[model samples]
Target: MSAALKIEEEREWKQEQKQERISPVTFTTDRTSSGATVYNVNRDYITHINVNLSPGCASPEAMDQMFKHIHATYSTPSLSVTRLPRTCEPPSDQITTTYLAVDPLYNSAILSIAEVRAMIGILQIMMVNPMLCSSQYLPETLADLKRTMTLMELAIRAYRHTDLVHSLSRAISIGVEQCRGLLEELTLNLASYRHSLASGALNLTRKYVWARAGQGSTMDALDYKLRKSHSSFAACLLALGYAAWPELKRGQLGKDTLDELAKFYVELEQESTSLRHIKVDTVIVQDHLGRDLPVPMIFCTSSQDFHVVIAGFCSGLAGDVLIQRGNYRILNAGDQVIDPKDFGTLFEPGMAVTMSILFYEKVEERQGIEGYSCPRCQHVNSRCTGWVTCAKCNGSFKISPEESIVSPETEQHADTDFIPNERSLFRKISISKYAPTSRRAAAAAASPAIANMAPSEPLKTENALSDGGVGDVALDVDDIELDEANMVEMNANTADVGFGEETYGMPFYIREKGTTNYLTSNGCRRAEGTQIIVHPRKNDFEKSAQVFYIDSYGALYHAASGLAVDIVDDVPCLRQLRPVSGRPNPWSHPLPEFSFINSQIRVKFLSDPAFPSCTDDLYPNGSWATKTFLLASNNEKDFHVHPISDFSRWIPTSDMEDSLSYDPKKRSEKTLRVLVERRTKDVGGARTSWEIVPK
Candidate 1:
């Protein structure tokens, strides 16, 4: 081995040993844990010592004296370092390092206040710079950048507190302007797309709008290729931008803005990847950005513009002004308030302002009949006027003259015997008292004779004797006895009548002067021999009072109050009763059974014809007399025959008894009489004397 090579090896071996023995200590400057430098401490201590050590211990400022003592102690050397290594060499050039030390005594020695303050200032600046940039160092880089700007502002405020107010205001204004500029750019893009679509260029409009929204910068070659391979990549980017910045909402591309955008990706038919269809209508850009944006430009599509404007109106946005346009007069939802001049700009001539206009026009075309004419009187008029009188017939009508005016009176008279005289009859009976009494007595006296005659018997019997005759009259006592025996047998064979059963007999007759009258048990008066005068002023058959007749069987028959005779001078006749074995007697009419329940009178009548005949008599003219009677058993103390010429005045004998009982605890007779009278009056008839009789 050569000397040179050995020397080189030795040097290398020494270098290796040196590398292994290198010290591990390294020194670097940093902020003190208490955020103050040693120089600052020393300076404060020196100032304190100078003030207190100069004999001020007993002064009024004793605290200041104690502080001075502390200062003196800190100013003096507490410990000292004599020597330190000057320089160090790298053993193998593997890494570089530095070391430092200070003489403890000198470092602790008194420092000038100015030098201390200067060092403190450096430390403060260092501390604040890191805080100002802390936002940059946080986890989210973009957010941190924003925060860094805010922190820098705070730093400026803290450092120069008085000047910060005006500076911060200016910075904020600048930030707002920047945001506004960006928003304006977005609005322009939206408007451009809308204009293109309105110009009938759908394809170009979509390409330009989507490209501007999705690629903030034109796509790189690789990015374009990747987007083509997975078109969803571009859509996702566009959605992200729209979410982050509400301004991007204007660039959504499609003619049917909401529908087209929703189907944009789906219509592309790129099925090789997983991507959700984006619904533009449902997409909420403003919500993501936490700011409200102007109405989206995509809504300006010709069809969508009208809908959006109408909807705005319905939502109560400037509705009054928006609805004023003649074209958009029929206000609906989504309408926008634009000047009439601006409305022309929104739509071209020949295009309908709204579909609603057609509907309104159709409604305006229908016209209903406004006037009517009377059919009967030929009166032409407007308005129903509720009721009117015919000019020709003087008949009242409810129908409008234009539609149908009818004379109901003439029509009723044609169909029925409803004479005007009947109405007047009600008023005549209401005033007259004598008409009722004579009617009832005549009915009662004739009932017995009427019941004895057969219904088929001739109204008159013939007399064969001459006016002058001389003859030998012979009486056959056997014949008289046989006739009497036959009469007794007939009376014994007569059927007994019950409350709900019938008796039969022939009607009887009566003769007055040269005229004969036929009276039926059913209370019909038939004049056979002579005419009975019917007073023109008094004969109102319909309003004539009713009269009830009691037959031998004790059943009632009803008769009309007015006499049915044409001769007013003739006296009326009473009829005789005749018994029939099997047939029902008209005089034995059943009375209605009635009781008071819950303050209302409830009546039950026998519906079967096998029951006693009802006092319903029909005259030749078709007017009938009806008698309704209430028969009650509970209150009956005794039976009584009550003659009532007016059916309306007849009251139940039981109700009268209930009222007239002597017992105080029972119903009072006065109350009963009063109630009966009231009830009789309600029925509208005149009553005769009531005769108490044994049942």
Candidate 2:
């Protein structure tokens, strides 16, 4: 190196003080990235910064100065902390909720180089336009996410020696106060925002919740992704914060929190897989190829009232999916209480069966980003995982951050569970020849009902006993019970309401009461009057969805796959539903109560028309889609809080599970005054009544 060149380098590295004061403070919603809102910058015209930002010779001081100046400059928008309306009108006022992204592995707090780079990338995007934060919302949130990610990484790096780990554990405890505080703030902010906005006005809807009314744009999705990334980081911090070295050594965390973490991953994988199989690629996530990506799966929830189970799916973050137990809440900042009363938690993430929360990268989809084999290396990843081997070294590599992009087939999802398919609502059923065949089905199937519904071919008999998946049996149509009381002719009064089970991926048959015929899958294809008859076949490409999971929160999820049972409206028909991974947590509602009904308990849908049994009477939305184990409710109110509400019930309809095989002959100490909802031949709507039942 020559002396002149050395001097030039030294001069380049010299940090210079500011030459002049930067512009005064202003605000702007328009940001350079066009993803999120920026704060205190001149939106009227572009502002240029003159500084070299290359490494070593790069001037960070100059960069900082430019950033400071940008912060100083401002363009005003209507941002006020006070007088934000709590109540809203229709459409705009349609109750909505905001959810956090899913992080099953809880890797946000870990200090891996790859994760750090990803965290930095996310922060850079947020800080890029620092003048557009939602006044108090995004600003504090971005700061917290950025700070915790960096500090944890630094803390771990400082503890390279095993002995050093002990010395530094206490230091982490002291420094993490800010991270903990910020996490609390973010949680409360998210909960309150959802609760307020769901019942609040519509246009303001976008301000707090993303993907509202299905109008969520590209930017809204980006913002949603950013939050999920931050959440992983937060959960990581919360788990590690204040821990002693002993706590670290044991690898033990509070079971409750750990269970929640388990939930996060389980939910993620389930939702993603379900979406892909169903071909409802509505959720969007980052391509896992980049080292600078956060937990890529968004959070998905059960599509039922007061659903507590949260799940998501991902290809990155060391797993394909994650799940956790979560509920939303409304907490005021600085008030500092997390109890449900003070903060008002709502665990009901309304309608995971309706729409999806994961938004896809529209631009990348157009570029044909996925589906090619590595012909040179003979590698096929099914997804564009950015797998590459150096021609010379055979070393592995990731798609460079400079080229970081997204792949949608990881079930390219946007927002929500679609709506009430008549099958989903489980409406009136008649003979296939007698069923309605005239109407048009919706443009898309919300549930997997269309693709995975019963086979489109004519009803054939399938024997129940076979080694193959939903294997080889021919069902005898004569077996269908013909008792007049159970099989009344079609008429308004004593009307024959048929809600034949339309199990796609065919499930075990359990006959409905008074019907000799077993409840079975009826192929859905905008076709009506389909017979609920079984088809004989050994399962091949089809995945069997058996072993239904009914969680404590009254959510009925497919155990093998985390897909929730849901319905769609407009052109009512059956649709299998799943939430996309990596979107914010769905807004939640209060969890419902449970009761024991001779082992098998049932959940009810509390609505204007409550679910009543075979009383020779029925209504459209009443008992439709309410599964054998699950119930439906139109009442969006506090079904969880009020055990006395007539809209809710826990009946034991052949509910004999292993756990429910209690001492029914004896009245135990845990006896509960169960509020059962029932309708009769004389009643107008179902009413709630007390039934003494064992817990």
Candidate 3:
């Protein structure tokens, strides 16, 4: 095996051992218990050189001698240092934590070209002391360092632009050559010293060579490694950043580099593949093609969420008949569309389920300056939105729209005609007929209830299994147990009460429990059936109205002013329920109003009361709940619930694999703690606890 492979294997073995030896630990709500401390880490000092030449110590005549010494000691194109009189103080808050050096002199010290470049990059963003940059008493040695820094900065900038790839590559080549030349010079000088020792001009040749050679060789090896790693990282960044450019196709990279990159790419692909399974809840459709038809398959992956669409046929027919039956050609990996029935036998019941939905793409034409054509869909438009609509089928949707995009709840009647009928194409199966009558029956059965619940919604809510509710066979006990801890926690004894006040503006209230009265934000009150304690700001009923108690399911139904009820349980309940007298209705029109339980909490829509309820009680069949919540929005399209699975896939940069794997013990000794505080309007008000912890 290659040396690289050997090193990697050994590293993996060490990591496994390390993981096995570590014990599991947890953090509680309390401020302090047991954990690594962040405060213990110490900052290193950064040295600043002040070149002051005095008449008695070093006169103007000694300038030439100083220059000779600097030239002989430091290997560089030039030698100079900026020197201005100023006290050296530590870095302050103006500096960003990202660029802060772990240690000023030792750990983060610049010993070679790679370190120099990295340090310059970091320092560029920092608020530097003006005295450090000024050349009031500039040393000659610092001038060369400045020159090198300037070149590196320019190279990095050029590398960022679209048209400077070739130039950047050439610059890197030159830098590598310069490094090689420096190493050769050091080697030659060492040989000369050895020759002097042989002539008895130098004493202790072995020790001298051992000391110098050891330091030089070690530094050289480190420099080389750093440069190589940086180069590889840069190349990857460039490739991924400009992947859409046609010029950067696979052929652009030279053979050896391409081979190395391909390996890296394959590794990334594997990682993404693993992540994809963890990130999505995909349904497996068996016999996707007709029994006699040969279906072409193309499997690809991306960093975003998307739906898969397949096309199949019920019977062999010509183009027009095929179109009428909603049977289209099957497009394969190579983009070739073939007859759906030509390659298969008659599709039997459960042969395959084919449907159409918008697939995800990487480019958006509508947003691009000069609309770029999508490589996935081959369509050109204004913005590169990274979504496409099937021109042939008229199915249009973004593959992965930004999280902020508003998706309003669809009116129940709006697309009734468009709903696909599975029974029309597949063998008619009675899901309800086969459903189990008891919990045990449900657990062991493989009936239609399982199929209905598996693809539509998640099987369990926060406390389904714990509550001993049985509905669909797809409902797993494990999933219910996993979600039980997250179930909503609310005060159960609170009775439904009315506070005749306008809900449009912020409402404040005080509820008396026992002898203590607790002042709380009316915003915290949700659910119709529960009576909430409200402390009115004013006693005038004409100005401030009493809040009313509505039914509860953790949703607050309030009759407020300026609010128009659009869809209440899929019905216009505005005309049905009017606000009680003494209640200042601030809603746009008199309508039944409801509040979201919490700003952070989202709930899923189960069914529309106006329509026949779906026979299957469980909607989804996963370990996590499938629920949707209405996000804050003025438009109907603003409310949509993302699947829990999709939400989990969005791991932030701070939670990347490396960051996640890094144990706190491995970090510097900085102990972090959580602090609890209580806030209230009065000095001796009822206490509500809040905790603060390190991010």
Q: Name the top lDDT candidate.
A: 3
**Residue ranges of candidate 1 with Cα displaced over 4 Å:** 1-357, 360-364, 367-695
For each candidate, the alpha-carbon lDDT, in order, equals 0.26, 0.27, 0.28
Find the candidate with the highest TM-score and give its number: 2
User: TM-scores of the models, in the given order?
Assistant: 0.12, 0.20, 0.19
For candidate 3, write residues 1-695 as lDDT tens digits. 69999999999778656644544332121122211112111122112111222113345357557645533433221233221112235544331111111111111112334544444343333213221122222222223233433343433332232223322332333343344343344345434544445545233544565466563454355345444434433333333322322222336434644454455444445433322322121222322222332221111110000011222122232222223333222333332332332122122222333322221211222344354333234355444343344343322223223211111221221123232332123211111001112332333332334445544454532223546874434455443322222121212111112211232223332233222222212222222211122232343341222222222212223333211222222222112222111111111111222332212112222121111232432223311112232212111221111222322343333324322321111111111111111111211222221111111
What is the Å distance of residue 432 in model 1 from its true position? Answer: 70
Candidate 1 yields a Cα-based lDDT of 0.26
Q: On residues 1-695, what C-alpha lDDT tens digit does candidate 1 reach at each position?
A: 69999999999778656644644432211222211112222212211111212112245367546545444455443345211222353323222121111111111111211232233243334324221111222213222223223332322222121111222222222232232233334335334434445445555544576466552232232223322322222232222223222111334322343343334323323431323442222111121112232222122222223333334333322221222232232111232223332231243322222221100111111125354333334354455454444454443333311211112332232224223332221111000001122222233334444446555442222222345543333223332333344445544333122111232122211111122211111112321211111111123342132222333222233234221211100111221111111111222112222222111222222111111222322121211111222211122232122122221132233224322321111122321211111122212122211211111
Clash number for model 2? 113
Per-residue lDDT value at 666 in model 2:
14
Write down the worst ten-residue block by lDDT for model 1: 426-435
Which ranges in model 2 have alpha carbons more than 4 Å from their true place? Answer: 1-126, 129-137, 146-507, 513-517, 523-695
Show the lowest summed lDDT stretch of 10 residues, model 3. 298-307
